[model samples]
Target: MTKKLIYNGTVLTMNPDRSVYKPGYVYIEHDTIREVGEWPQDGSKQALLESASWVHDAEGKVIVPGLVNTHTHLFQTFIRGVSDDMPLAQWLRQIIWPSSLAMEAEDFYLAALIGCIENLKSGATYIMDHHYVHTYPENDDGVLRAMEESGIRGCMARGGVDLSYEPKLRETEEEIFANTDKLLDQWDGAASGRIEIAMGPLNLYGCSRAFLEHAAKYSERRQLISHIHVAETSDQIENTKARFGLRNLELLEAVGLLGPKTQVVHGVWLDDGELESIARAKASVVHCPVSNMYLASGVARVPDMLKLGINVALGTDGPGSNNCQDNLEVLKFTACLHKVNQLDSTLLPPMEVLQLATVNGARAMGRERDLGSLEPGKKADVVVVDLRKAHISPVHRASSALVYNANGNDVDTVLVNGQVVVEHGACTLVDEQEIIRRAQARVDRLRAKLAPEYPVFRVVE
Candidate 1:
């Protein structure tokens, strides 16, 4: 097996017991870490030659487990910043759906690729993409190809939303099931261990009970996680209550969708009982703090969720909602916003926030054993951030600096499964500029071609 050594850095394992920052050297073999310690020492030269391939000097940079994005719509990269200030319903009904409907398979491929590239460069090694806009069968193939090309580890959910205010957005039950099955068959395990597929049954208010139950069963029989949107907005909560006569989490539990392998995205309006149910079920929650604030969809009770023993992961949501796919910003916003919202600076402590972005996120994605920490036997999913920045000066505590002060721009290098995906703040596997150019061209064409058809939102500049 191939091996590599990364030494001379401060390592944060993100493990519950050994989560604190400590200086160390890590040795990796193949895709798994072999050994790690506070200092490097000479080993048997013959054994080293037989296994080790290369060695990297980290130069005292801070090494942390790569960030995990629990929820994202990679195909929405083209709509980033288009309707930044709109509410959740307005953003979805007006700007997002129209643009998404206009997007072709090629456009989606480019956009997903761009999203993956940007994510890796920003220190996110794994992303759980709730990729919902598959207008055609070919679109699924294109999205999978883009994920393969980026070399990032992710679970791509073939998202299906069967109800919308617009009739065109609604789909027949047969169509949704067929598409989800086709997507799963096509790309479930396409990239050796890097890419996997899951079922993303849009949201509670958008999907029927039959659809949710079917999707949950399908995922269970296939041994895959059930990815779904829960309690995202106040209106959705109200609608769920009105129609089902139960709250959102209660609806999910009644539908038999809440369990150990379930991941609920954007749970911004859950009540106390719902929170307890989530913890008891051992399910996960994706906290999109910036997106929630952007859409006025109430801040998630993440600090409380943690207290109740729920796994709270970080997410950027979709570009249409968050306007940017940056986990660094998610870390910062979650740490600061929750503390202020709860009026307790002690509420999401620095180390806890860091865990949400790292280990908690990995757990939410069902990849904690392999990808969450800088420990021996874990996957070499790692990120190196420059600690010598002006904003990060006089670092009293590494964890505090990481959650409160560090930005995506500080991520200088990223490695996924021991392969360098992003170096010097740029992706190594794809042409970043070419990806951006094609993405912009697709956006421009879609806007120009569909401008006249859209009445609620202007598609043109």
Candidate 2:
């Protein structure tokens, strides 16, 4: 029954009409937004403002719906800067796989904590974490614990690779399904409904056709979302075609995996027919521009996907791949990468890029009715960007400044579920410094344990 009022800010309501209110005020009652409109400066509403339990004066700030990171690997935070400037296959074979094998449940917990803190400070309210490094059952529990403690809302896509390309950390088909069911029983609808469990079969190369069909059917029956990496690299598509005589998307469709609730990450090498099939199925594609460019995975046909009526959302991929958990960076890169790739400056305007992170992301998560926009009756997940910074000063357009000029450090305050989780660019729920310290400690241990087996690559400065 606690009420709060945030007034005197530039509000970007990503509504259907894309309304922007200057000197706006958002009234909140507990976890829901009660009203969003221009601040009543006259004495007529002074009495109503005085009735709120708490009031936040957001002068010289821009308020928008909290940025949504539709896909990420929270457990990969430990592997940041470990394997860079390498192709996806070699990177996984040498550094990532070995490091994952040496990690324990505690390592996963600490890494997820660090990742969640980084995401929160970067104005992200929700993270669809694809945690596939479950060497043990406690590994799954570790990630869930970190998400709950970090106070961020998200879906935990418990991922597993059955047909392992690597030597260790492989589970059988029965074991994968049983573990997934255990996770669903324990974590689905947990964290006061802030965390949801989804089915995450690692990818086509790592999972069998039988496993994919089983995961899709289970996800549909349980009313959960199914997430997987699809056609991210050219090698994957070629290998799938070589093995099944079908492309990745064709295989998925043949197995009945494409649907509204299915989210395919990084559709970089898809064909025209595959794109049409995805749009027809009402499936979503999460474009990780930074990760794709960093891993040299080639650019996704985002414009083509959008033109075909496919729902496209933004993702940071993984901390290991992108080396940062900032959605602002993702937002800016999504806008710029397409324009340069397509050689058209008008493509992917600021408003459209911002929508990919907000409403489109919510649609990918199937929570469009409740989350995404700063509309009344929606959950009060909002971010306040301080525009007084040197880079963001002289703002001509709020949306333009948000996407182009501003970065994650400009995020001053973040509210998830009507509770302030970050204030003045720091997390409020967890000890961020301590999380970083512990995560680094775990990383050190992992590196030492795997050093003899996998030597570090030296770089000349």
Candidate 3:
């Protein structure tokens, strides 16, 4: 393994002690960390230095474990600002569903590529994309190829639904299964551990019990996470209760789908019993605070869940709901929103909030052993923020500033598995100008074709 040294930086570590605000150095050996902190100049350290293939100056940057986005629709990066000012159900029915139905394979690839660039530049090293818009099997391969080309780690969930956003979205179960099988076979473990495939049933209301069972069985056999949308809204919960005679989480549990590998998104309306169920099942939740606030969905009892020892991670959801795919914004919003909601300034402190974005997210996606922290034998997934600036200067507390004040524009560099993917606020894998042009053009065409009555596209320059 090649060795690299990153010297003269403040390492956040996010270790067990929640260590913060310390000047330290890091040693990287290929995909794993060798050592961190200002160590003694001993003989063993000399030997490690002699083995180094390269060295880089961190130059007073703030080093944190790469952010993890546990739930996102990367393909929806093109839909930013489209379905604003609506309830979740209405947003899905009137705008999101129609736009997705109009998407083609090229559109999926371009959108996913741009989403990857946005995520990496914002310091998120890993993404769990709940891809639900594949109209055909070929698009699945297209999306995974885009993820590979962008050079980010991802968990791709093949979104399946027996029903559609409207009567128009209904595909035969055969079609769903065919595309799903194709997705799992092609995208699972693609790109040498940079990408993974999982079962993404759109939501409980849209899928039949049999489909849920099949997804659970397949996920278990493969030891993959079963990602789904559950209890995101009160209406959905009520509808599920009225139809299935149980709440959404209860329905999922009754169908034998609640387990360690299950990851549910939003979960704004999960009751105490459901929280207990999640705690007992060792399942995880992806909390999209910005999206939930945007849609006016109730605040997900996140503090309660945290107190119950349930694993909760941060996600931006999608551009349509979040209006942007910035993990830095997610971190800041998550940290402050909960404190305000609970009427206590101590709700989610900087250390705990940072953990939600990194280690907790890795645990949710079943990649905790490999991708969460700057520890030995873990992947060299890391991000550097320029803390010399005025906003982050006078660093009394690294976690406090990172979680409360820092933004995506402050991210100076990002690395995935020891490779530099984003540098100086731009992606190394794809051309930024070309991506913007193609994204704008695709959004225009889609608007013209699907929502002509809305307006011609007017993207801000």
Which predicted model would earn the best TM-score? 2
TM-scores of the candidates are 0.94, 0.97, 0.94
| Candidate 3 lDDT over residue span 213-293, tens digit each | 877777787777888999988988988887789999999999878998999899999889999999999999999999999
On lDDT, who's better, 1 or 2? 2
> Any residue pairs clashing in model 3, and if so which?
none
For residues 1-461, could you state the per-residue lDDT of candidate 1 as single tens digits?
77887667777777768654356767788788887766534543335434567766666478888999888888888888766678878787778878888888788889889888878877899998887765676877787788888989988887776665446567777787787677677677777778788878888988888878887788788878888889988898889888879888999999888999989888888999999999999999989998888888898888788889999889988887887887887888988888889888878777878888888888888888787888888988989887778989778777778887888888888888888788778888899998788778888788787667765335545
lDDT of 1: 0.81
On lDDT, who's better, 1 or 3?
A: 3
Model 2, residue 388: distance off in Å is: 1.0
Give the Cα-based TM-score of candidate 1 against the true structure: 0.94
Off by over 4 Å in 3: 39-51, 451-461
Best by lDDT: 2
Provide the overall lDDT of each model, using Cα atoms, as 2-decimal numbers. Answer: 0.81, 0.88, 0.83
- RMSD, each candidate, Å? 2.4, 1.4, 2.3
Count clashing pairs, candidate 3.
0
284, model 1: CA deviation in Å?
0.8
